[model samples]
Target: MYSYDVKVLPKNTSLWGGVGIEKAISSNSLLICRNDELGVSLKLFTKNQDDGAVPFGTLAPGETYIFRLNEVTLIGAKTTDDVSDSMVRCTIVCPQSN
Candidate 1:
C-alpha cells in the first residue's frame, strides 16, 4: 500500500486541465479523497481528461471516491473553482508480488 497527495490546479473556462496519477503500475484499487480544509470541489476523471464534457464525478470537501481496476490506469483530477487550487489524497493497493 502506498499513498500520496496530489495538487490540483484551477482550469480555464475553455481548457480542461488536470493532474493525472500514473504511479500505480500494478495496483488493483485506488482511493481518492478531497482535503477537508479546502473549499473547492474536486473533479475526477478516468483514463483521460474529458475535454469539455462533464467529469466522471465530483467530490466535495472531505468526501472520498474509489476506483477498482484489473490493471494500471490513469486517474485525473482538477478543481471546480477556476481561481483556487485544491488537493486530494490518493491511496493505492496492489497485490503482493511473489
Candidate 2:
C-alpha cells in the first residue's frame, strides 16, 4: 500500500474510491465524510436522516479515519475553520497496482 494527499480546501472536494487505491483519512481538524448511497459499511450517517448522510464524527486535530471498501465509492468533505486556505488533508492508501 502507498499514501497520497487528498486535500479539502475552503470549498468542497470529492474523494472517490477505486480498486487500485484504498482511502484512509487522518485529519488535523473536523472533517466531514458524506456518502449519497445507503447500506455501505464505511459510510457515516445520522439517525434523523434516512438518506444515510453523516459526518466522520469530528476528526480531532490529530485523528485518522480508515475506510474499507471492495468497490468504488464517492464521498465529500471540507474543513470547519473555513480559512482562506483551510484544508483537510487525507493520506490515501493505494495498492501497488495504482
Winning candidate number (TM-score): 1
Model 2, range 71-95, lDDT digits (tens) per residue? 2243444444555322334444443
Tens-place lDDT digits, model 1, residues 5-80: 7777775221112334333344455454545565577676655332333357877777877666433345566688
- Look at candidate 2 and give me any clashing residue pairs: none
lDDT of 1 at 60: 79
Evaluated against the true structure, the overall lDDT of model 1 is: 0.57
Alpha-carbon lDDT, every model: 0.57, 0.38
RMSD of 2: 11.8
Where does model 2 exceed 4 Å of error?
18-54, 84-98
